[model samples]
Target chain A: MRITNFLFDKVGKWSKQFSNLPDRYIKRAMEQVYWRNPKGIQYKPNAVVKRKKYHFSVHRPWTGEFRQENSPGRLHPKVFVEPIKEWSFFRGDRVEILVGKDKGKQGIIKQIFQERNWVIVEGLNCKLKQIGDDKEFSGVYIQEEKPLLVTTDVKLVDPSDLTATTIEWRFTEDGDKVRVSTRTGRIIPIPASVEETIDYKTKATYLEQPKDTKADAVTEITFEPKLATFEMDIMEKMGIKDDRVPPKSFWY
Target chain B: MANLRVMCKLLKNLNISNVKAHSIPSDRRYKNWGAQEVKSGRSWKKEELRLKSNSDLHKYVLLKERNMLLTMEEEAKAQIQLFPSPERIDKVEDSMENLESVIRERNVAYHKLETGRTGERPYKMSKNAFGLRYRHEMSEYTMPKHMNKDWYEEFRSYKHDRYTEQFLLKYREKSYVSKRRQQIRDFNHVIHLLNRFPDMDMQALKEQYPNVDIEKAKASRKYGGHFAPK
Candidate 1:
């Protein structure tokens, strides 16, 4: 099986992109394996009894809340998400609400849940949730933004007219893919905020940590083609020599 | 006892500090202790590793980083303290894997150009004693298969017998049952999706489940929603 199929099959690219965590880390943190075949000569060499499917919610797969929701022995109804050819909505894109009380109002996308074709618009489509109500205490109510279906509940806003417009994917003369407004026939530029993540606003402006390799050192091209294998080259560079070659080996 | 105490005092007064090569220094432990979070950039990409020389890639930087992270994690567990940035281990591992893959690619290209064969370990689909087919990676030995009596004794292939045939029949049936169940589950799920989203893109659905027969699924009773005829 392909590695991506097992690792990030359920996690949509947009959902995990904002967290700025490696795919390996997310897979390691979220997997709940109950049993696995031990290393030995066995009938089944690599049999792994693990949770094959997960219920994607507003909480990300690596979060504690998601674990609580998908705790052991708790089964959730299967969610059927309509498959879309391409994901057009992204964080910081101006979108108009097409459903609910917030219909016709425009807001920027704060988060995306691509697995369910869901997005939460900033300050729009909110519901009041009561928290920590007690016998003697009045509960505090807070406004929580609810996820809206991107297919039926929102439309991208055309930058030229600032109105909701249908969009189509098109290519420019330079071969760069762009989103074009179908109504105005204008190119709706993707905002710079698309690159914003929890760690930094953009990769170029990311503050290098104490352990980060310097940028120039990483980009330096030090490789020179040679008529030798990696081992041969390394051994030659290290001045290691092995002249004895009388042993014959067989493979079965 | 007094003389031993005086010796201990003398030893203490000498200010002798025991240092070991493997142990993390006490000063570094103090720095790592009680830290809530540790920040780091992403791991090395394949493109970056490709630009590196063979000697530079062979250095033990990635291995040392992994060993240090593992040591720190073990220490944190032993002390019942939080391990800051456990993801750093994954980052280091990811870099190591990328570095290995890049080296493998270069090696494969060189082998293909020189010897017209991949330099990787050879494997073949062979049956075990149980008659189950598995990929058997070939290993080097001093003796050939004809002369190796121990190898034959250990890895003897399945012999035809009544009990063996019955076991194979049951195993195949079990595999077929699981496969059939999976196909049925996908069929029902596709029908549900079609029922829910009547105007859903058919091409996308077909692309998602290439095995499912969409025309047959549309003809099922569960394909349409419960509503009065318009």
Candidate 2:
């Protein structure tokens, strides 16, 4: 497989779920193809030379910062990201800090970088930095919350008791998967806000754009199975008669 | 200047809006030309397209949208400005793909029910001049293979030759070297991963690099950390 396909796999499902963009769009926006095989037969057919590795930091792959970080010929060290079996953390998830000054303090998950198993809590694990500091003036300080590893730096909070607890994925009698708090054995429901994206809060609330097909129109089924191929059906509907047979031809 | 102004007046009165530019009738421009982003819904799902009739599929006016997007993208490139919501192109393309697939499915279903064969284009796995196997998509010709001198001239069926024999030897050697290098690289990468993340998920590592022997990688000299043993 190509490195582009490999990098595409690195992008976590839950991490990009909030974008609400199609997978194809994300792949198109993020990939930097330096060279590709032109339209002709060659020794190496369909060969492409593109950036092999990327520095996946706090910056999203589709952002300007990510492009800058992964600028041509500027290679970063290999990142050893632990492979996760299943992603449980999501946007709007309440989690407690485990290894910082804000330890035991709970905050909602504001952003996630599943590439590195990192998540940014709403207002926790912050570090102050001074920007544009010069001799003539003391620069203003800004607090930025850094990402924390979901494995060691944070734990999900059980909504039932409002305390940090380990959770296990369990299926109910109805066959719906739910995250159950192991400490209290109570079902911590996934929030409705999980479906929130940059475009719209929910699918129902999405405002229809000018080019968008109406919901009712899309749902209306007009298909009736016919004993003809697509082209045949279309020609019949258009009232085009073709009785002349094609000339004899051979296939090698 | 006065003559130019008069010409402009005449042109305005003539109503040149109907004039086609490069075969495109509409003024090729995006609706949200100056906006920060162009918001749109996701691509039409295959399930949704399957419900549409043949005429509805034929009436799908996606070509104009594609043309407009290409024009806007070119303009943005020329001006060095960010093309807002580039994803619209991808969405359109994805929807087009879904539409075509849905149409193909219907056609295939009809053909299979009638002819007891997949109505797809016929192809066969055949060797090329270089002795490499590729799917040869069969095409219609006016005459049989033996009689079609033009086809034979163009294709030149594979034949054993001294030059080709030597070429194949070197090509196979090159391929083998690259394949070996790739295996070594994968092994080294796995070792480095283990060194950095000792407690990493083994299943994931195995899944990612299925070719690398996990036990062999662990037993390598470079596997452990460079720390003093307690």
Candidate 3:
């Protein structure tokens, strides 16, 4: 127990000194150390001490073992939170402002920040920004667009009549998923790169040529046969004499 | 001769009339009657509306109004009692809006044919509080901005005061500090990555972090470790 405590203290102090080191390097070092002295050390189990009505839980009891077996270090807070899904709107989609000062105004979506559910529409919401000193530039004011518009404040515009329309997910007769305008009941074409899966049902079917028919056509064509004495005649004209020798006869 | 006369009279009495049914269409709300007395079609397209006469358009409007009233009554009944899908109200409202817009378009077209002007609201160039110019729909009874005393007073109060300016200054300073801290963190992370991966793609790293000076990061002592300088 004294030797195990001493080893734990030494490793703990060394690890504490290099706490700021990158995770991968520390993990590599720990793996090497673990393999070098596999049976020399053991991890101390977590202890729960209870008093009256209170409970105290202690983890990583000086044996230099991680709290979680597989995980090398502490888990990040972000890992516990699920990431936000992507919004429906994309850059270059025509949208109408639903509320605020620019209500009923239509513009193309210039940018989208899915993380914050914010979008920037081109030439829709504008604000005045004070630029330069009033004394130096004589009250130079530049009209700038607002940083972002909330995603909920904008609605997609139907391309048919350029009016605000709600979208509904629907399946086509060919079993392909498509977006349909709730107002007009018209199918809205899926924008490129937005939907990853290709609909094979919508693809045109080509008539395949019969394999037997192609083979029959090839067999129908006739080929002229070459004379077997043609090569010998050619060799004789070239003055190359053939020397005939029997088997098992020695010749230089 | 009497039997033939009686048969002809019976056939005449059994003759089917061509008069269409006047009953309202049955929907999912009606449990007993699933068959529709009258066939209902989709919303009127622009081309179809253009081909329709004024009287025809008016008749369509009346029919839509009746359907909308019936839907409203059904929705009210459903609201009083819990219904499985409350979205039926929204669907009814959307169809009503579409019908009304189609009617409005035909009305505008008819008015334009009679008069030399479009029967739509006119827009005027207006400026907001930020002094940004925009086209605003003109109101029927709105006074001029300069003439309205209440509006002028409100506009005067809308300007940023001294406290607002101070708050903005402090907010900008806080945002700048946060941005600077983010940059420092990114730089340190890049340095750590370089120390761990000596053969890492330099170009990709540079592209990923444009703000960090790659040369400066390479020259830093923290990235050099315990090795002597060559």
Candidate 4:
């Protein structure tokens, strides 16, 4: 298939291209001129925005992956600056919800937040107390506001997988640094690039379940934290095509 | 620590500012010929960049682009084969383009700041005869076509078909939460890289960021380098 190079040019040309439309629509589209691809720069990933760095307001739009947990109509996310616990690092490390209804989910850690903590694990453990009439009162009490852990809980992944494709650094006596499947002893090489940058995860590390990878089916997400930094930046700062994001309290 | 410093100084002494000599034993020409500049490196990081003023930033960006262009020119001058990926130069060009645009925007903002135009008056938006809608801003859009304010209002209510709808569906994609999340993820990832391989070479960071001062990153408490427990 031939690739389209529309992104090579800014969409502002649309302002002059489509000069006739409804006022409201035109207004919406006008706002879009500043909103959509306002600038071209890889500013998101590998970023630090605490003080000096420029920080733009993030827009919320549903990425299809978020539906695995909550529907758009009923969203309860959490936001925060740090994981509640220090020792609780990702992939088993400490984790906390930074936004939404279930703002704080502790204990389950060692996972990465793709977009929000809600997407990682069912973490918001606090129960919301709804006061009701005397007829419904079994006594004054409280309940868990939401879950504390979901399938999306952050976790740590192994780096050995990345080095598998890397060129051999040391060779004393044994074979090359490439790994063999622990069970079947099959070498899993991407076979695309001989360069060291090629990241080939051995079966022992990344077990791509057919269900999850199969496009036709609704794949179940297993608790696997051994993932790689595939997409450099999914955020706007990164000059990419994806234009999707989850609402507030997803993750910090 | 002192050895790398000495080597760094020695490399500098050679008067080859753009190239660095490798200390690695793997290079066959460690004694005969030396490590010429196969690849120089990327430029400064955000923290260093933040320290620079607006003019300095512009000059720095221009210097980088010019240096990169000169480097590419030198490659041809040496009669060596052109880089397999000339897009590397394109990437450099793209960065220069971005820097120039950002500077231009900042200059305009500065001009606005100078003029004492504090609060921006809300401008009305409408479509013209060509089904195109634009914000009527007198600040810059005061030309011949833009002056046709009536033409814009007249066709401001036209319908668009499916094909037209696709190209017009442009909108900002990221939000505060998502961008923050991704940044946190990337930061944690750097930390994770340090944690997992405390013994990993600090020089590797130089490969990832040849221009960035790795010494600063090393000094950071967050840097996951191996050290004797206190």
Candidate 5:
């Protein structure tokens, strides 16, 4: 049993080494063989070949394993930008419809489909759809926002004057980049929540402030009763002597 | 008389040095009283915007916003008188977008200067179900992919089912048959050419159809045509 175990271990190690032959060494050996006989021995063309060289006329039976290389009318997948372009209009932004039957109508953007370049404007360009027969709410006609308008059909309304305006980018003297109105030259302030995330300078400036250390310094002053006499005189003239007290007509 | 009135109105408001206090009306503000006319300037190009100072850009943006508002107002008031131009809104929106993107570019540059890294969200290359790679912005998550129970379940769902494997097998078979048919067509065309042009360059024929053995094709009965001995 001991001899058999030893023989098995030796065979296993030999097999592992044989399997792990270096590919580089094998490649180098091939190169040596090619160098020894650069122009390898040529063979004479066989006069009566058993098999045909070209299979042009021969039709091979279809094997289910082989796939067709060219599927008829197979279209290449089209690559498109996900959001089309960087969208400037956001939900709730007041916009005026620029085209279609609802042209000149104003409404806030309700939903944005950036990929499709479509936007649904609230309370504008709506269509009426009759609800199907139902137990509680049958025959009701509901007004629904129409199919989304292409982003190009809507123009953003400036918050300052509730007007549509073109925007331009400009850097302030302090090196802050802000959106500016092209028409009025007004600096369009970013929304507070969005500004908080992007404006790191503001936070850094706050951090750099000197800590207050005048907690011990305290002062107090009292007003004399004479100072209150003018107020009392006015109240007396109006027939209300006690101004501090609530009037009978006063309801809490 | 309408032209004179419009000219006078424009002249009155044409203080270039000082920014206009009131918004311009979109209606016949630029038009002659009796005639329909299209009058507007082109959008501000990036190069033009870059040439101007920060104050100047601000003024331009403000001016555009005011013009858009006035145009909208005019359209609203003259609902029966005139039809609003459809492209006007698109042009204004486009100008605004270009302006904002330029501002964002500057912001990114400034952020890079102040900080070592860009302030924009980080994205990584991710493959979709179709094996096409796309840039996916990374989001903050409490747990890692392997550790997240929901993510693990979703990953398992992405595995190919038996039906999918069967479909793939059929698709592959179809592809192979189409490829074989194309090769056969090419081979037949080459043989027909050889039969007609017996003196055709053998090297050129080999080069044209690399897979088709020209020597073997010449020896074949098909290349000899009907007149040659079978």
Candidate 6:
């Protein structure tokens, strides 16, 4: 009711909004409960028993730098934050990173940040080169390749929720895949069947692992058996020649 | 409860309720805003709603809850009547849409009287539109205990007579006129749009138009719904 003027001042469209309210609904609400000083409680003479109508403003708990703070840019891709903790049931789970220099690198996201958007991985092979004037050079003008953020170096770990929440768990261990509650850190486990197959070592359960898998098979071979196999494209039956891909993709 | 369920059904039909606004107290999937198991007693200050039977307190809470619903609905209606431009109206529409969600929670909680309430409901101790943050309808403030010489001295030093009311008035006067001016402009726009586009989809128009009532606009003298007789 008080903001009617504030609403009205923003006239263009909001003006129409308030004008349409039924007068009946817009009427000032009557105070249902009335507080009165009883005759017995009345002061004998100049004793002032005051009633202060206390009021306060409710501010949002969060105040931080937001992407939405400056402009109404196109919506960013939906960020899914999966936890990688000390005792996770799943293994070698990968999360798509969306921010920073090594963004879009599908490293198996190792850890999550509740307060910030920092994450850690086994090792990221990155190269950073310094570019500037050679006037104040110590030895010679040259660019240095360096790893920007290491396991020790703090990287920006983005969170899905703008208003940071704790975590929520569905169930206890070995139940559902545990997920942090939106704000609170209560674990919500995803239901897992007892019949679910366990991966021992580098057990390749191929759900169409691409060329990336070819490299992985040699480097990180495990003892576990391939749980399931499928020949999606029976190249032999189709009589199609599996030609070599461009060397630029795998090599230089 | 039945009425609220019907409202939910309506929202369901509208394809608006992507998130469930109502949930049972025991339901784990939805983190209800501590609605069920409302510990009734006094208004944060333990004198008003306390010392009474549970039924009286229920009645009190219900009345306040209903007023909140009324305000939301009124605001929604006014938004359409005042802001007719698509973009500005879109802003109002977006806000109204969110308000609908807030209403869903309120409506569900109000209806689920038997379920009881838990935790703090939707309200926060909010400041009014004015730059001041005043404690609102639902606040959890208790008078300080252990009345000592310090309490008497501190409280007695400063007078607090009608500060909240005084604060409210100052803001009201400041915001009052411009709001009315906005209302007039919107009403005119609604009148113009209807006169221009008579066969408009009334409901869609209602959703998009804030300042003008499509039906009323058509019925106005300038826009007399003029067309060939059917």
* Candidate maximizing TM-score: 1
Residue A127 lDDT in candidate 6: 46
Where does model 3 exceed 4 Å of error? A1-252, B1-141, B157-161, B224-230
For model 5, the stretches where C-alpha displacement exceeds 4 angstroms are A1-252, B1-35, B54-87, B128-133, B139-230
Angstrom error of the Cα, residue B175, model 5: value is 13
* TM-score of candidate 2 chain A against the true chain A: 0.92
B13-105: candidate 1 lDDT, tens digit per residue: 111123233676777656756797787667777887899889888766677778778998998999999898788888888888888999999
User: Which runs of model 4 end up more than 4 angstroms from their true locations?
Assistant: A1-252, B1-37, B43-47, B58-81, B84-87, B101-125, B128-230
The docking category that best describes candidate 6 is incorrect
Better of 3 and 4 by DockQ: 4
TM-score of chain B of each: 0.78, 0.80, 0.39, 0.30, 0.42, 0.28
In candidate 4, position A160 carries an lDDT of: 38
On a 0 to 1 TM-score scale, where does candidate 2 land against the true structure?
0.88
Q: What lDDT tens digits, residue by residue, belong to model 3 across residues B162-207?
A: 7656766776787799778867866776777687667555775776
lDDT of 3: 0.46
Residue-by-residue lDDT tens digits, candidate 2, B107-223:
889889999888888899876787666778899888889998888787776786987789889999998997888788888888988887777778878877888899999999988
How do the residues B1-230 of candidate 6 rate in per-residue lDDT, one tens digit apiece? Answer: 22121111101111112323344256553222323221111011122112222222122323333343345445546654321111222222333444444334443544455355522334544433333543333422233334345544532322334775686677577578767776665566666655554554456455444555656665667665557989
Q: How does model 1 do on interface RMSD, in angstroms?
A: 17.5
What lDDT tens digits, residue by residue, belong to model 1 across residues A112-212?
Answer: 99988999999999999999999999899999999999889999999888999989999999999999999999998998888788877766567666456
Looking at model 6, residue B155 earns an lDDT score of 27
Clashes of 1: 0
Least well predicted 10-residue stretch by lDDT in candidate 1 chain B = B5-14
| Candidate 2 residue pairs in backbone clash | none
lDDT of 4 by residue, B72-121 (tens): 55766686644332223433444455545544444445446667443334
For candidate 5, report its TM-score: 0.26
**Which number leads on DockQ?**
2
